[model samples]
Target: MGQDAIAPPNGITHIVWDWNGTLLDDNHANLAALNQVCAEFGRAPVELEYWRAVFRRPLLACYEELFGRPLADEEWARLNQTYDRHYSSLLPSCRLADGALQVLTSWTGRGRTQSLLSMAAHRHLEPLITERGLTRHFTRVDGRRHDGAHDSKAEHLVQHLEAQGISPSTVALIGDIDDDARAAREAGAHAVLVATGLMSRARLEATGHPVADSAAEAVAMLGD
Candidate 1:
């Protein structure tokens, strides 16, 4: 809502991408790290199938549900700290989804405006992007401020748009889940979803929302 209302220059640039499931194909990493944390804290680990279903706002909300109560500030920090450690160890095995790098490369070639807005903590997200050699493709990478509670990706997207002077008309939110689509709508930008994320093709299609099968397709749709 705080963003400028004008349309972007006629060329159609300035993209906002969702990282997990969208870019890095790291939802499995998240599930693995979180489950590892659960084990460390004497809680049951959630399966990836369930994680895909319950992952949502308030970063710690899903964990709280699994832990049966809210974690203390210290406990929350420990979980975050430990999760990063576990996730980092597993990063070598993480792979970029099909066409992700190519799409990012195509966008970068034009020197367009772009950024990464994700629910994953900034600490972990940065290194992952850097390691994958995808950091250079984006003009900016933003995540939660890490102030204990989970930061909503929607809020981050709105803030980033305001700070970057991006207009809603020119900016399209590219993501792969309902949350991503909802955040784009909330931020007054077009939501262009990719089916490659945690969401199923059927579910994505069922929404009757504008969607792409891959990042390349998203880039093409945005050009239209």
Candidate 2:
């Protein structure tokens, strides 16, 4: 007789979501914005697949990779300024990913709690979430304070849980990148990644976390 394959650890009482490519679906806008920035620097435009494959944090490294050289502090700042301006102008046309709203609503309806955590600047992030009328769904919404723009999510995730009086062990973090899994584990929570971000499924799977194709699928893996 053979035993069953073990199911992944997804049992949790709370869900924490990542913004940007996960829920916001701003991949097109982000690519176009970066391409425009590259144009100013006399670099060729990059295809989405190439961009996705190379994208990772500390945003500075991703910028350097796209430009094919090291960026001085001033050059990096200028590039980021241009990218942010174009991105903001294009953002009104973007929308959330498929099943993003349904998953958030479904999780809430089940009487469990959820919140949002993003590396976006807080001033910008708050208004955007408010404009979408999504504020009611989250127990708390956190975005970076701008002073730590290039840092990872682990530190912020720690603060988010502590502020909510939620224990990390009872949490499940859903995000679209490998960093999300690393950050979640570093902060002592379960991680489930969706392949909806810049990273491919194979790449996300390499993080050794359960991977899903969409937000609804990710939440479902966490079970009842």
Candidate 3:
């Protein structure tokens, strides 16, 4: 049987969700924001496929890849500010992914505990979640502190699971990127990558985690 046929661990009492590309359908906004920055830098605009294929953590690395060279600290900072400004402006046009509500509702109905973890700043993340009316579905919403650094989620995952008193083995992380799977592994939790997010199926599959095409499919893999 294929890897997708493999069942999730038994007794999955909790789920950790990655908010950006996973729960929120902000991929287009992300791409547009990046393209806006590229325009300012006189760089070629990146297509969605290119964005999906090359996106990764340590945000600088992704920028470097796109620019074809290392960015000076000052340049990186400006690019970050530019992208954030454009993305925030585009937020009003963003929406939740298809079937995301159904999946969250079904999981909640089944008495499953769910929490949101994101690399976005806490100040920004909470407002967006609240504005979307998704606050009630999550037991906790953890976002990065306003340190102006795009760090990995591994450390956050460790702290989040520990604070919740949830065993890693009894939890799964549903996300869209390899960093998400890496964070889940670091926390000793199962990683389920949904293809309907920022990264492409090929990239997510390269992480050797089960890849689902949608939130509903991811829930099916996690099981009840």
Best by lDDT: 2
Whichever of 1 and 2 has more TM-score, that candidate is 2
lDDT of 3 by residue, 1-224 (tens): 12343345567878899988888898889989999999988898989998888888888888888888899999998998999999999999988889899989989999888999998988999988998899999988989864433468888888888888888998999999988988888789988889977789987877778888887888788765
lDDT of 1 by residue, 1-224 (tens): 12222221235578898887777777677778888998999987777666666655566776798788988989999998999898878878778877888888878787777888887778767877787677788878887665433355666788878988888767888888777766777777776778776666555555455667777877887664
Off by over 4 Å in 1: 1-12, 109-112, 146-150, 198-208
Instruction: Give the clashing pairs for model 3.
Output: none
**Rank by TM-score (best first):** 2, 3, 1
Candidate 3 residues lying further than 4 Å off, grouped into runs, are 1-7, 146-150
Among all windows of 10 consecutive residues in model 3, the one with the lowest summed lDDT is 1-10
Model 2, CA-based lDDT: 0.86
Clashing pairs in 2: none
- Please give the CA lDDT of all the candidate structures: 0.74, 0.86, 0.85
Q: Distance (Å) between predicted and true CA of 83, model 1? A: 1.7
The alpha-carbon root-mean-square deviation between model 2 and the true structure, to one decimal in Å, is 3.7
How well is each residue in 66-152 modelled by candidate 2, as lDDT tens digits?
A: 777999989888987999999999999989999899989988888899999998888889999999999999999999865554468
